[model samples]
Every structure is written in structure tokens, then in C-alpha cells.
Target: MTEPADAKAVRAAETAVAAEAPDGAGASIRAEHLVQRFGSGRGAVLAVDDVSFELDREPARIVSLVGQSGSGKSTIARQVLGLQRPTSGAVTYGGKDVLRLNRKQRSEFRRNVQPVFQDPYAIFNPFYRVDRVFWTAVRKLTDLPNKRAADEAIRDSLRAVKLQPESVLGRYPHQLSGGQRQRIMLARIHLLRPQFVIADEPTSMLDAQTRRGFLDILQDFRVRYGITTLFITHDLSSVHYLGGDIMVINKGRIVEQGAVAEVMAAPSHDYTRLLLASVPAPDPDQRWTERIDIGQIR
Candidate 1:
């Protein structure tokens, strides 16, 4: 992490900053001057360039990060998850610089923020029981009493994602529908009860019906656990449906960011207008499987 900042020095800076902007329990996550680059200082590819955002209050509020491929949304999400250290800035969870955290602190923060990756089909193993995924998560994150207590926690967690726990038990990932498997991923995080979820294109791989259902299920989780979400997608219509606030990114930069209504109704940035122009219109003649991809936008 010293490739970006010295950890001891960062702790001191965090201490000073926390004294100034004491967000208390309201601040779930925050990123300041977040930059992710690959290569050297003078010449490098900028994956995420000085991007800064925060989620304070609005416990279950949903925010969507919309951008083309390589626009840095995923990179920023990784930074928020503490997977990648920032090249320059800082990412903080509850007043501390999380990138500087030790193993114990890192594990604790992980329970607060978990990722729900796209492509649910690839999210699991054919070898291990699907329940094993959840069980392993529980083992790593918590120390419950016994198998019964762990099983109870698993059941409650699956129920949170609208899954029938009994139906999914002892099943392999390949046996479940794409939706069910994705729900299992959500269920795993719910078991941990993370305060925020960074969902990277959670619905991209599903069919239209399943995609809509995915949205409903996630919204249900929000209602159940009061989980704030940084929902990442390239779909404008999906954003219209689920986003409380919208941030449009282009080539590793934020073009516009604000409430969904204001941003979409009157998109000031050209890139955002491009996104608006690019929403698929319903055509009865077209195949229902018509998909939205990065290439479709002009």
C-alpha cells in the first residue's frame, strides 16, 4: 500500500480528518481523490482518475454507477471493497483509512462491504455443495456455536434473499437457475449483514424476466437489512428503475452525479444524454432476448 501512501502516515491523516468531518454512524463509506493507475508515475494507464464519492445517510438508498467498459466503475468498486489500493487518494469506512488496515481490521471491514459480481453462472463451484459457499463465508466471518446455529443463520440469510433454504441445501451451483445462484451470493452477504453492497452488473447475465426479478429481490434485501448499494451497470433503463442517485462516468471521469430524477430528466452532460438516447425501446417485433451491451451506445 506504500506504493500509494505510507500506512502509519495515513493513519495520522485519517485521525485529523475524522476530527474535522465526524460523520458518526451516518457515513457508511467514503472515497477521496481515488485514483487507480497501472505503470509508472510519469506514464501510466489511468483506470480510475481522481474519482471521489461518498455514501453517508440514506440507509437503503440505491446509487448506480453507469459507464462504458473501462470507464473505471469496476476499478472504483474494487477500491471501495479494499481489493485494490488507491494510487493516490484514500478510501475510508467509518472514519478510518481502510486501505491501511491490518488483517483483523480488513476482515471486519469485509463484513461491512461485500461484492456481488456479475455472471452468476461463474460465481460458484460444481465440486462443492452450494451450501458450502455459504458455510465457508460464515466460518471466515463469524464463530457461531455449532452446526445447528450455523444452519439457522444460513436459513435466515437465504430467506432474506427470497430463497427457500431447504430447496437449495446440498445442491451444486450447476443445478440451480442463474437467478437462484445469484440469490445465493446475496444470501451469503446478508448472513454477514453488510452495511453496503457493491453490485457490479448484478443483472447483466440474466434474461429480461429474471433481470427484473433480480432488481425486485435486491430491493427486497435493501428493505430487509437497510443496505445501501452502489449498483454498477451500463443500463440506463435499469438505472431509471432502481437508482436513487445516478453518476455518469466516461473514460475514468465523472460527468454528472445527482438524484436520478434530475439527472435523467435533464441530463446536462453529453455523455449522459448519449446514455439516455441509448435506452432500448420496446418493440413487439423484436426478440425478447434482445440484450444491451457496451457497443450499443454511440
Candidate 2:
């Protein structure tokens, strides 16, 4: 997007958000019977099959979407981020249909809803300085009088993500480590404080230690700013650590969903049970095995 377009989008978003008074307690993001299919007729493939869920933003929370590859997790994430249009159903933010939003509404949605994809490098331009993303965001997201004020705001946001300004400001994307890049993306999101955030495999690339810290960062942001998040991943442990509801998807359909404790204790669906069992146990004597008979269940 051009700088002018970015500025316009930010302005429109701010206006729309300001126009609506905070209702305080309600569903912030909702997906109503979403279905996405590729191709048509007999050859059609259902990428997301009749999925529905809600991410409550009023009190701030994390909602986990867990599924292995090809289980429709990423497809659902794309739909929620407005990156893809489902063949059926709708995704709404504050009761506004995402697919049918007007230009102004689109701007508001753009500002209020943000996404962090799995690959951090994919989100940045290698030619530009790493800090360019933050600077551009500040210019478009806020109306600070001059560059100095924007720079200060940028520094503050960087600190929130534990990034030192001088260390990364002049570096190119290639110069930074994968973890650093991911943190930068988080910092960008923190600066915006969007109403809803969609994170898809955000920590999959990080080491175990880094992944734990990354999850903590997300938790900190949630506690500090009351930002709602939809965390998409294949890791059940991460979901358990994040502390939110879990939705298990299989072949584009949500087979089971409920509070973390309830579902983890006793998963009803075979797919869900299989997913939980797949989590490795620390004790060698307690190694997990598929306790369910998948053939009979399906």
C-alpha cells in the first residue's frame, strides 16, 4: 500500500472506531457458520467446513485454534483476518460483516484487526531498514506533530517488546534473527493495540526457550492492554499455557470445542483425543499412545 493510502486507511479507521462507543461487554469477533471450499462440483475440496466460534474482547482473552496440517486451522485464520472469503457464512467484528464491509468500514477493520503470520521474514521487505515498518505504522496509525514525537513513540513500543532502538533501527530484515523479527512484529501490533489479533504459528520457528518467552510476551500484552487474540497453532502445550478456550478442527470442521480444562480433561471427539494424546509426556513411563479407535469413531 502507498503511503497516502495507508494514511487514509488509518484516519478512516480511527474515525469509525471513535464513532462507536465502547459497549464494554460483548463478542468482539464472531464467525458464523463459515465454510470455504476450493474448486467446484465433484472435484471441490472443503478447506473449512461449517466452522463457528467467538473471540471475546471485552474482558480480553486468548482463543486457540488447534489442528495439524490440512486440518483447516490456517484457512480459518485467513477468514478471520479477512484475507480470504469463505464460500458460505460470515466473519463479523462488532457485528459488521467483514467480507461486505464498505471502504470506511474496511479501514476500521484494517486498523482494529491485525495479523501475525508464521514466517516473520515474509512480512518484511529485505531492502528496507527493519525500523521502517514501525515508523510507517506510527505515521499512519497516529498523528504525532513531527518526526521527533513519532520517534519517541516508536522507541517506547520497541521497549515494550524488549528491543533496543539503536540495535535494530538501522539493520535490514536479513540482518536480524528469526526471533528478533517476530518480536518486531509483536511490537508493531503492540503499538497499534488493535481490538483483535490473529496469530498463526507465531512461535513455530522459535526454539523451545524462545517460544516460551514469546507466549509470555503475548500474555503480558493481553493483561496490560486487554487485547483479544486468536492464537492458531498445532501445539497443545502452547494452548494450555496461553489459558483460553480450544477448538479442535478436522478436515475443515470443528469436531470439539470448550474451555481448556474441560476439553483437556475429557475430549469427546476422536480427533481431539488424538491431538491431546500426541502431546509428549515428560516421564518416559507415561509415554502417550492413541487410546481411541479412530476407525470406529469416524
Candidate 3:
């Protein structure tokens, strides 16, 4: 089914707002002096040191948090998605202080700002149908009854993510390929129809070719659905393809922030430059292992 003209226009208007820079009022996501540390004993480590940025949010703007393994890219995502709270800092979303909200207070914000995790493979359970995720979504967002509305919602979500529901509904997680499973996660976002999506390394597990293809899918979603996105990745190469505005993080701090092309062309900080230099050039003789294991995250 096609999106309605009014909906499309609303999305377009939202897109316009998101595309605005920091000078305007469209900063949908803002983090101020954000600090996140893990463990309080002898082994305490800083996950996100002092990250800060104002991202224009609506539908069209695509912001990337690029950094190294310990740069706290995913950590920032968690704080924004409300999966984790900052040890000391403030995250204001649409004029609401995220930390101030109780479970019931934050429900609407939670629905508006959903998350797409890194491991697409682990998104679903093998014992349940793919719709189980949607079941949880329905329970949280709407009061849909019976199989019919639920199934239709699932199918529509699948369509938004460019997957055929008939091919995927009853299938187990193991039945689909890596990229397909990731798209299914995207489908869940479509059902939720969030204003913003915090995608924490959503395509990180895929091969280089698949990863590149998945970028288009995400961009299309941002454009078509008018969903603002926080695309977080440790790799800098992805910035060129996905980032409209860039936030370079290192040792838990935001070292740089600006337009994607400008940041790529002339990165101000040495750390950001080092990151830009690290993007694997498309060399014919180069082999792609695409493995950057940073140990098991808790």
C-alpha cells in the first residue's frame, strides 16, 4: 500500500525541519555533557566520557555518531534510546528531560524514539513467530485484538522495510539471511512508526556488499517515512554514505560535529582525521574480513 498524500506531505514537512542545522529550532535530539561509566569498584571503566551534541530531528535529517571501538558510539545510542541512563548528564528529547520521566512518563517518548540494535540475528527468538516482536509492539503502542489486525500490522511493517510478509511471517530467525533479518528489524520500526530511530550498528554484522546495500534501505526509510535517524557506527567509511551531519566521538567525547561532506573533506581534530584515514578504500586487491570484535558487550 502506498502512503497517503497528506501523510507524505506531513513527512516532507518533517523532513524539512530535520534538515535544518543547529541554528534553527528543529533539534529533536540533544545531549549535554553526557557521561556514562560502568562499574564503581576497582574495574570501573568509562564507556561514554562527556559526549555532547544537538541533532536536528524530524524525518529527513540523518545524523551519524562515528568513533572507535571504545569511542562510546553504541553507548550514546543506548542513552538516547532510553535503554540505559547516563551516569551524569542530561538528554532532552522534544523538550522533555529524559531522565526526569518515570516509566509511565517516558512511554510516549519511548514509542516515538525506538531502537534498532546492532545484532540483527539476535533480534528475534527461534521459538516464536516473527510477529512476536510486533506482538510486544502492539501491546505497548496499540490495543489491536486478535490475529487479523496484528497480522496486517506485521505485513504492512514488512512492506515498509521492503520485505514480503508472506515470505517471512511464519519463518524462524534462522530461515532468513543476515541482511533480510536486519530488514525485518527495520520492519518493526515501520510498525512502530516512530519519529526517530536510534539504529545502533544495525548493519554491522553484514558483509561489505550487504552493508552498502542496507545503507540505501535505511536512507529510503528516512526519506519515505520521514523518520529522523541516529546512525551510530565505529567505522568512519559509513559516514560518507550515511551521515548528513557527523559527530566524531573518541574516548567517550564528541571531538567533532558538522556536515558530513565538510567533516570528511577536512576534519578538524586529529582523532577525526585518523578515523577518516581508516575507512577502507575500495581497492581491487584488498580482501575484506570485516571483523572488528571488541569483546563481548554486557
Candidate 4:
């Protein structure tokens, strides 16, 4: 189905925002001393407190922000995505502060920076065909001039995500499993070919087999497309699987951060050690209740 002309024009305007910048030129994303607070007085809460980090373009790295619930990881992701303004500090792409960008620059930012949200079901409309999600993204985010070309692009992306277009094209969201829906999300992102991706628990909903498959595709993108990713999740196992830098956040503060190997091998901070110790082991004797010290929880 073709998109309405008005909707198509809006999409064109959004993608055109970054037309001046050569595609893929903006490689790095940096969060500088960001602080996001809500409410005031006693009711006020600091969600992300003075968190700063950078995702470098060189090596096309995956940066994992690991934290328990309420650690403010999602808040930081939102700040980076330009969905929410920080109370202080800034998120910059290629050295330009995202929140401070003009309309055109903001549009460019949108085109280059894409997000794969935590809930695949929440991202799609139940009423539309699953393929509609892919085609709609093509209509708005890309400039493939004709139907034939667009179909080829869609087919390639679906294959990349391990979804056969013939099987998934005419189906609705409910007709697909959680894993298939997540793959669709990845396929949509593949079509956009964004420089940086904000992946908020992208694999959290899938089963073991499907989870690994989804993550493999993501790793492939990092290696092949040179896409830098801000991977946010509560799973330390996933962090280890992705094999990148790890930043451990606790109660809105960064408890520890460094290369995944370095942090895992010798966690200097109390919270980091606590997180590592909390990981469940296959040995029945290695119970978390016994290994974890209650005193170090701060």
C-alpha cells in the first residue's frame, strides 16, 4: 500500500534534514555530564545524574549500559535519542549538541540516530500487516523511487534479519511470534541504515534461540555496517555476549565502566562486583543468596 501524499511529504522533510551531511559522516555519539531530574523539592528525583560517555566511530564499537531497574539507563537512552531534554549537560553527535540543534539539524539527527525499542509489540500496529511496518519505513525514511526497487530493498533487509519476505510480508503483528516481531524491528532498522542505534533491551523478550539469533544479526550490523550502538539492558550475559565496553550504573550514578574484559576480570567498584556476583551460575551450589553480601548494595 502507498503512503498518503501528505504523510510522504512529512517523511521526506524528516529525512531531508540531514541531506547536507554526507550519509554516514556523523559517526560518534557523546553524552556530556548529563543530568535529568523530575519534580522538585522532596518529591524531586534525579534519574540520570552526571552520566557521561562516548561511543566512538573507530572500530564500530557496541557500548553496553548495564543496570538494574530504576538505575536510570533508559533515561540516559532517551536523552541520547533527543526524545527528552536534559536538565543539564548535553548529548552530541559528531560534536554537535543534539538538543541544541536547529530544525534541519534535528531532522538530520533523526535520520542518523535510530532506536530499537525494548517492546517489539508496542512498536507495531496490530491492525497493519507486518510488512507494512517495513514498507512504511521505506516510504518515509528512504528515497527508493519506484515499487520494484523498494521491494528489492525490503527483501534484502528481511533476509538480513533472517526473515523470509514471502513468509512475513502479508502477516499482521499478532500472527508473528515475539522473536519474529523483533526481527522485523531489526529489518526496519537495517533499511534505514542509521549510523548510530539506541537498542533498549532489544533481545529481552525473545527465547534463548531467538535471542541469540537477534543478537547475532545486531553484531553483524556492527561489523558490516559500522553501526555504533548504545545497548541498554539489565542482562550482564548479553553484555558479555556483545563483547564491548561496559558501563555499570547504580541509582543514577556510574559505578564502574571500562572494557568488558577489564571490568569482568577485576571489578574495582563495590557495585560492579555486586552485579557480577549476582549473575546466576549453572552450579546449584553457587547460589546468589549466599555469594552476595547485603551490605555492599549501595
Give a tens-digit lDDT track for model 3, residues 222-288: 8887777888886555666676888877788888899999988888998776765655564533423
- Give each model's whole-structure lDDT: 0.74, 0.75, 0.69, 0.77
TM-score on alpha carbons, each prediction: 0.84, 0.85, 0.80, 0.87
Model 2: per-residue lDDT, tens digit, 1-298? Answer: 1123222322333443321323323537889999999998999999998999888776788888888777787778778877678899999977888878776566667676777767778767678998878876766655566889878888888889888988888999999998998899888888787777788878777776677778888888889988888898877777877877888878888899888889988999988877777666534333222121122223
Ranking by TM-score: 4, 2, 1, 3
Predictions: Cα RMSD each: 7.0, 5.7, 8.8, 5.7
The candidate that achieves the highest lDDT relative to the unseen native structure: 4
Q: Higher-lDDT candidate among 3 and 4?
A: 4
Model 1 per-residue lDDT tens digits across residues 1-298: 0112222221222222111112244656888998888888788889888888887546577888999877888788878877778889989987789878655455556666667777655546568889877776666665676889999999988887788988998998888988888788777777766678888887877777777777876777688777788999987667766758888888888889999999978999988888877766645444235655554664
Runs in model 4 with CA error above 4 Å? 1-26, 281-298
lDDT of 4: 0.77
Better of 2 and 3 by lDDT: 2
Identify the superior model by TM-score, candidate 1 or candidate 2: 2
Reference-based TM-score, model 3: 0.80
Q: Which TM-score value belongs to model 1?
A: 0.84
By summed lDDT, the worst window of 10 consecutive residues in model 3 runs over 12-21
